[model samples]
Target: MIKTKCFFCKKSYTIDYSDSQYQKIKANPKAYYVCKKCNESMQREAQSTTGLDMDVIDKYDKFLR
Candidate 1:
């Protein structure tokens, strides 16, 4: 069975689709498993935000490029 548990809020849904949906989401295929509520909250935050900043090690990773 496909687990639909959103890694963010840990909310389980009736449909199990995230794992199988990784390819359809983005070019890198990095899966962010977030349930509906948390997903909506993140969406709101993203919409209100501007330039993104990489945290610590993430900054180093970008420094390589």
Candidate 2:
């Protein structure tokens, strides 16, 4: 089990290697793992914001390239 701390909420959680892509994440320094509650709240906040969703825009741009 790998113990991880949520960057947003400062919560400590454990990741089971069998259930999560722990090794892949460990290989990438830029990769992050957030708690489910924090992730859901962030998504909700993003949806409520005005203007284009930068996350979607970035994906679309990548798709076009």
Candidate 3:
């Protein structure tokens, strides 16, 4: 499993998705992973880099985040 930092607190954790998490995501094409603390920070970063407002940031961050 790969290690990634939590978007919320930036704490690192390895992905340990169960079969159910996989199936849930697979069944729902719109589902995605979120780094708890990093999400909002990352979203702002994307917006600054791309010249988008918060609304656009949220909309596009779904794809980029």
TM-score of each: 0.41, 0.57, 0.36
Write candidate 2's Cα lDDT for 1-65 as tens digits: 77777778988777776634467557763467777788768866886785556567577644432
The alpha-carbon lDDT assigned to residue 40 of candidate 2 equals 64
Cα error, residue 10 of model 1, in Å, equals 1.1
lDDT of 3: 0.56
Residue by residue across 1-65, what tens digits does model 3's lDDT show? Answer: 44444435757555545422344445654455455456667867987898978765366645633
Q: How far does residue 18 in candidate 3 sit from its true spot (Å)?
A: 17
Query: Which prediction has more favorable TM-score, 1 or 3?
Result: 1
How much lDDT does candidate 2 score?
0.67
Candidate 3: RMSD to truth: 8.2
Q: State the lDDT of candidate 1 residue by residue for 1-65, as single tens digits.
A: 33345677677644434434444444333455565577657755864584454444265644433
How many backbone collisions does model 3 have?
A: 6
- Worst ten-residue run, lDDT, model 3? 16-25
Preferred candidate (TM-score higher): 2 or 3: 2
Report the number of backbone clashes for model 2: 0
**Root-mean-square deviation per candidate:** 9.6, 5.9, 8.2
Worst 10 residues of 1 by lDDT: 20-29
Where model 3 places Cα greater than 4 Å from the true spot, the runs are 1-33, 57-65
Which scores better on lDDT, 1 or 2?
A: 2
